[model samples]
Target: MSKIKIVTDSIANLTDEEIKVYDVHIVNLNVLVDGVSYIDSDEKIAKETFYQVLKEAKELPKTSQPSIGTFLDVYDSFEDGTEIISIHVASSLSGTASAAQQAGDLSKNHVTVIDSEFADRGQAYQVIEAAKLAQAGASKEEILEKIKDVKEKTTLYISVFSLDNLVRGGRVSRAKGLLSNLLNVKVIFEFKDGVLTPMQKGRGSKSIQKFLDEQVYPKLETLTVKECSLSYVCLTEFLHEQIDKLKSMFQEQVLHIGFTVPTVCIHTGEGAFAMMYYHD
Candidate 1:
C-alpha cells in the first residue's frame, strides 16, 4: 500500500493537464539561445517562439539535461514512504536518464529510473503507461517489466523535410545530410534504444508514409495494440492536416495529437513530424 510517484523530463512533450491528470512530476530541461540559458516555462516562452528563435537566431540553440541535483531536489519533496518511478528520454540521445539514475543512487528510498530509448511523444507514451500501471498498485519490479514490454512494441515514425536542423542538431554529418538531400532522398529516422537512427530513405512524404504503413505498422500488430496509445508530434501546426489523414485511416484507434515542445522543435525545425505508438 505504498504511494508511488511518476517523473519525467520536459522533452516528453507532456501537457500540463496530462501531467496533473496522471500525477506525473516533470523535470525541466534547459534551453540555451544566443548564450542565454533558461528553464522551459510554458507561461513565458511559447513553443512557437522557441522554435522561431531557433530558426531565425544567428547561433544554434542548445539543450541541457536536468542535473543530478535537480532530481535529488525532487526526490526530497516526495512524502515519506513514497516510491518513485522516473521514466526519462532515450539515454543514447540525452544524459537525463543517467542523471536521474545517479540521483536515485543517492536516495535512501526506493527509486526506479527507466531509459525509454526514445524522445518526445515516444518517451511520453512510456511515462503514461508506467503511470497507469503504478496507479493500479503494481510493484516497482512489475511496473518496470510492463514498461519493458510496452517499449518493445512501441513504434517511432519520423520524416524530416530539411537537413539543416539535423546537421545543427548533430544528428547527421553535414556532408552526408547535404548529399542525401541533393539526391532527393528524404530519410526516415527511428528512435531505438535512445538514438535517432536511420531506418530507411524515401523520395518524399508519400513514400515515407508508405514505409511506415508497410514496415512499421506490422510491428504494432505483434503486441496487441488494443490497449495502446498513439501520439503525433509535429514541428509546426501546419502539419495537422497530414495528421488528420493518418487519423482517418485508423479511425477506430484512439489517437492523441499535439505540437512538439520547444526543446524538440529546436532540433527538428519546421516540416518535421513524428508519430509514436505504444502497444501491449
Candidate 2:
C-alpha cells in the first residue's frame, strides 16, 4: 500500500511545529528586491528582517511563484507508489498552483493538486486538514471531501489603514491612494472566491474597530470556531486591543498570531492585519 505525502506553498504561514508534526513539504516562492532574490519562507528569512526590507525598499519588491522545476524535484524525490497531495494558495492570488499543476502533469509519480481558494492562514487551514487525513491512511476521495468542508467553513478578512503599497504595486491608482492617505480612509476586505472583495469602506481606525465589534465578534459567538490565526505587518495599538478581545472570546490557547506572508505585506502595507477563522 502506498502512503500519502502532503505538499504546500509558502503562503500557508504554517508554524515550524505544525510543519514538523505533520511532515509537510513546503515549496517557497521568491521576492526580488532590487537585484537580490529572497526565498519567502519562514525557514529561510526572519520575519523582522523581511518586513524591514519591504519597508526600506525604494520600489515595490517583485514576487514570483515557485518554478515548475522546483515542484518536479520535490515530486520526483518520492519513491514509486507514493501518493502526493499538493495543496496551494488560490489560483487568482498567485501562479504557484499553476506551477504545481504543470509539474504534476509532467512527473512520473501520481500527483494531485488542489487550489484552496484562499491564502495565509486560510490556506493553512486546508493544508493542515489534508495532512491530518493523509496521516490516518484516508483515501484520496475522503481527503478531498474533508478539504472541501474546511474550505467551505474557513473565512479570511483583512483590514488596511492605507493604500500606499497598493498604489506602488499598481493595484490601485495613485490618485486614489493619495486621496485615501489624505482622508485617512480605511478598508476592510473579505477574501472570497479567491478575490479580495471590499466589504466595508469607511474613514479612520474607529470604523475598523466598529466593524469588528458589530460584525466579527457577534458572528463568532454563534458558531463553534475550531481555530483562528492573526496575521499582520505591524502590531499597532488597535491590533493589541483586538488581540485582547480575541483571547477573551476564544481563549488564547486557540489563537496563532504572527506575521503574514511577505507577498501579503507588499500589498496591504503597514497597519494592515488579517483575521482567519476555521469554524465548525
Candidate 3:
C-alpha cells in the first residue's frame, strides 16, 4: 500500500491543534504590509497580530500565493512513491492551485492537486475531511471523491461590517464604500460556484441576523451537519454574542472558532465574521 500525505496552504485558516492532529502539511502564503513581507504562519505573524497590524497600518496588505518552488520543496520532503493530495483556495481568488499543479508535474512522486473552490474555513473543511479519509486507509481516488462530495455539500456565509478594506484592496469603489459606511450598511456574501457572491445587504447586525435566520437556518436544519467552523477578523463583544447564539442553535453539533487569516482580512476588513460548514 502506498503512503498518503495531505497538503494545504495557510489560507485554509487551520488551527495548530488541527494541523498537528491531522498531520497536514501547510505551505505559508506571503503577506506584504507597507512593503514588509511576512510568512503567514501561526508562529510568525499570528492571526491576532495580523489583524492588529492591519487595523493600525496606513496601507492595506497584499497577499501572494506560494511559488512553484515552494510546492516542489514540500513534495520532495515526502518519500518516493508516496501519494500526495494538495488542496488549495479557489483558483478564481488565487493562483495557488495552479502553482501546485505545476510543481506536481515536476515532482517524482504522484501528486493530485485539488482546487477547493473555497477559502478560509470553507477550504479548511475540505482539507480536514480529506485528511480523515486518508487516515482511514482510503485510496487516493477515494479521498478525491470524498473531497468532491464535501465541496458540493459545503456552504459558507460571511458578513462584512465595513467596506474600508475592500475599497483599499480595490475590490470596492471608494465612493460606494463611503456610501455604505454612511448608511451603516452590512453586506452578506455567500461562497458558491467558486465565487463570493453578494446575497443581501442590511442596515445593521440585527437585520443581517434576520437574513440569516430566514435564509440560512432553514437550509441548515434540513441537512446533517458533519462539521462547522467560524472565522473572524477581530473578536468583539458582538462576535462573542453571536457565537453564543450559534452555540445555542447548534447544540448538537461541534463548532470551531478562530481568527481569519491576513489574506482574507485584506478584503473583509475588521469585524468581519464568517460561518462555514460541511453537511451530508
All candidates in order of TM-score, best leading: 2, 3, 1
Per-model C-alpha lDDT, please?
0.75, 0.86, 0.86
Question: What C-alpha RMSD separates each model from the true structure?
Answer: 2.9, 1.8, 2.0
Clashing pairs for model 1 are 117-194
Model 1 C-alpha lDDT per residue in residues 60-151, reported as the tens digit of each score = 77889989999998987888677899998887767899999999988866788988888777788778878887778888888888788878
1-280 per-residue lDDT for model 3 (tens digits): 3289999999998888889999899999898888888888745567876778887777778889899999999999999999999999998788899999999999989899999999998899889989988888898889999999989988998889998887877666799889989999998888886776778887888877787779877777787888777899899887887688768767644787778888888889888988888888
Which stretches of candidate 1 lie above 4 Å from their native place? Answer: 216-241, 251-253
In model 3, state the lDDT of residue 235.
90
Candidate 2 ranges with C-alpha deviation above 4 Å: 42-44, 170-178
TM-score of each: 0.87, 0.94, 0.93
lDDT of 2 at 241: 91
* Candidate 2 local lDDT, residue 194: 88
